[model samples]
Target: MSNEFNDEFVKEIPDHVRQRLDQTYEKIRFQSKKKKKHNIWMRMTAAACCLLIVGIASTSEPVKAAISGIFKFNDSGIEQAVNAGFAEETDQSATNENVRITLDSYFSDYNKIGFSFQLLFEDPTLLSGKVEWISLDVRLKNGDGEYIVEFIPDTKPLYGKSDYSVGVHVMNPIIEQKTGIAQFDTVFDSTEGNFPALSNAVIEVESINVQYANGEFKKIDGEWNLPLNKAAKPFEVVEYVARESDKIKIVKANGNPTSLSLTISIDGEPTETPFAIMKVVDEQGIEYEAGSTNMTVKKGYTLISTTFPISSFVHAEKLQLIVGNEEVELTKTND
Candidate 1:
């Protein structure tokens, strides 16, 4: 039985079937080897694709190393974006290590109300610097699609401690109402001051130019006129008198008996002093001897006289007398 089993196993297979089996085995082996090679190639391709993606991302929008940044307004978010475009353009234009630019109100809106900007930049080098000059162009448009006014800075080159002329341009050639020019100084880091020193730097508004759509620009020429002095009239002393005599004598008789001879001095306002009658009062309640005849002041008496305007005395409530450093109150009498 073992010999018979051996003989059956050793029997030759049909040619067609043998050939088909051989072909099927070879195809299976080729497919397995091809799959292994394909897997390796796929992994390499994936790794290459990842490296290319990383390289593109790194070079696309490279980060900038800015040395100094200048912000003009309190809210400069929008202005910063607009300036970014300028900066990009400038970056392509020049090759400098340091750059500075002054920004003015004309860059933003037509209202002539915008913050000024000053920028300082440093390149990644020891040499080669750049400076960019920028300013706003303000123009007002009317309903007729015509510019009512075109405002621009003057042609004077901006320099340190130099005045720049600013004004408006008209469509017409006529020059009329042009504003004056104001000069101001620009502060830099080398000014030997603190951070706030730059802030205190003044921007003088020199001349203002106004233009009409009809092409007419007028140069309004005039110094800044100050308002007239309308200050309220200061307090004025209408009447002042110093009594030095110990024995009070009434030389003049008015309707009231309290009249006495007084030396008067006045200060302030321009007016004629009205005739005033004076009165004499003693420590004891005693009236001085005076007849119906109006007594004239005794001669050889030291009587100093001065006059003041009526407006000065209008607000005086009471008249006080200082005799020997003693203040004496006097009653007001109708004269």
Candidate 2:
């Protein structure tokens, strides 16, 4: 019985049982302590990272606020006014807006001629924004009834810088032709034309009226005039006869002539006068006539040479004769 009880007790208590229990307890305690340390380190690291992020966020806020403030207050009210003014100036739909006029040219017959102009505008700003549309009623006058010209912008969503160009045409009744003469006489006659044979014509231009932003119209006064002259007539010819008896001779030769003897007179004086012959030419050749001779009278005269030969004529039909700085054309007579 005693041996059986001892064997049962030994079987219940296996070898190394106590040692295994002790090692298991030690591992559990070490693991618990390690877990606690790891949790504490994680909390500390998270707190430090949060502090760094918050510090960066706090330091950057003031710079953003300062930049925003500079943009808000630095620009003067002038920029605002200018922007508004420009918007108002370009707004074609706006009533009583300021208009711009660029003068190109002026005509006198109650008509604006070659007049080109543009509306002006200023830069846009945060205060004034942009212009949308503008309208203006312009009147041009010169103590006569007012001539009207309107301007409107053609753009949509009116914004930024903008301007418009307007053209005006003026017409008057004084410059119109008379239709009565054409109906009365259809035949073409140089002396009885329907148009006025005016020697000279004059035109005048006066003032321009501009409407401002306040719906008030202002007068910009100016004057322009144009004078026109008639065209010249074609040239004509006159004749004079020479009465001298002395013979004329060409002494020197210079250039070719169209006629042998020129029937030209100097200051209405006949060719018989002892004029200083500068150049003479016949139909075939040119010769300079020089001699000491006197004139009987300052009236019409003829030239005949008793000493010089007549065969040296430069031209036969017409003669260009120069006497005492005066030039005249001489035609040969058949007689």
Candidate 3:
């Protein structure tokens, strides 16, 4: 069985693709300590990285057909929202220092905003060889000169930081397979609370730094402030009777129909934090899980909230919350 499994799967992966995967893993391992929590890194590897490798390596016709023509580097939640007409189609472009940055599109909800961007280089050979990583300094502001979001580091795992206005966490940018064009998505989530009704918000791109496999670096220094329209849509909230266990209590759930995202918040007296809730299964036993999660303990109460990109669970006849070894039933309020 082991020989057959590897002969069919492992040997099919191209040497170059394998090397790329190894490099990406090493990079993530090196950056994991400084940039992200260990759990977040684990989730990324499990969902994104693993799937990416398999999608690239798999020779099956069905697998190729499944992944073909999709933007390989997008958050599933935001992508679904965009598909459901919950995003702004902004084809705006600004060129600086030989690099053309285009804000291809964006989606915004109560607590987060995501951008899909493309970087085109005049020198087509800019991505000639192994590209290590690409980093962008992005900022968003409202008309009143107030910063809409800013990335914060080392916010506590349980109780989030309260002093900051909006602590935004920027996950690493992903590059598409095409040459001379680096298409990627970046999501900025508010750690403090939900975002306000924004108007006249403009995304500012200060600079972009790219590192190649040769250890040489290329930097683009300039500012591009592109106008953004529309305020974020409020999340659809559903109230529950608040069920409780010894350590955790289920409060309410927030959902977005367009994005197919669900956020479950649990509040109870602080005790041992439950293990990560990785997957959610509905009555039919179909599973879905995607999106970011965080917990907060405020005012002597612990609050754990996680968002998942499950479209069906919003209206599922029966839904269950699975965290660690604890499985709690979720009953919705009557319509």
Ranked candidates, highest TM-score first: 3, 2, 1
- TM-score for predicted model 2 compared with the true structure: 0.16
- Alpha carbon lDDT of each predicted model: 0.22, 0.22, 0.49
Residue 301, candidate 3: Cα error in Å is: 3.3
- Misplaced by over 4 Å in model 2 are 1-278, 283-285, 297-309, 312-315
Task: Compose the digit string of candidate 3's lDDT tens values, residues 1-335.
Answer: 00012233222324554354444333221122322221231233221232221222122232112223222234444445555566666667788878788776676665456676667667757766666555565666767766655321122121222222222222223343333556545555443225555677887787775656566767677877677754554445443343666655665554443223333344444355456544556666655553445455455565554455543214664556666677666665675
Checking candidate 3 for backbone clashes, the offending pairs are 159-297
In candidate 2, position 136 carries an lDDT of: 22
Candidate 1: regions farther than 4 A off: 1-76, 79-197, 221-335
Per-residue lDDT tens digits of candidate 2, residues 46-136?
1111110000011122211211111011112111212222111111111112212222222111101112122222211210211111112
lDDT of 1 at 137: 28
Candidate 3: C-alpha lDDT: 0.49
Measured on C-alpha atoms, candidate 1 has an lDDT of: 0.22
Considering summed lDDT, which 10 consecutive residues are worst modelled in model 3? 152-161
- State the lDDT of candidate 1 residue by residue for 1-335, as single tens digits: 00011232222333443343233222211011211111111111111111100000112111222212222211122223334331111121111223322232222111111222222223322112210111122222323333222222333222222111111111110111111111111111100000110111222322333222333333322222111122211221222233334433222211111112233222222132122332233333322211111111223332222111111122233444433234445443432
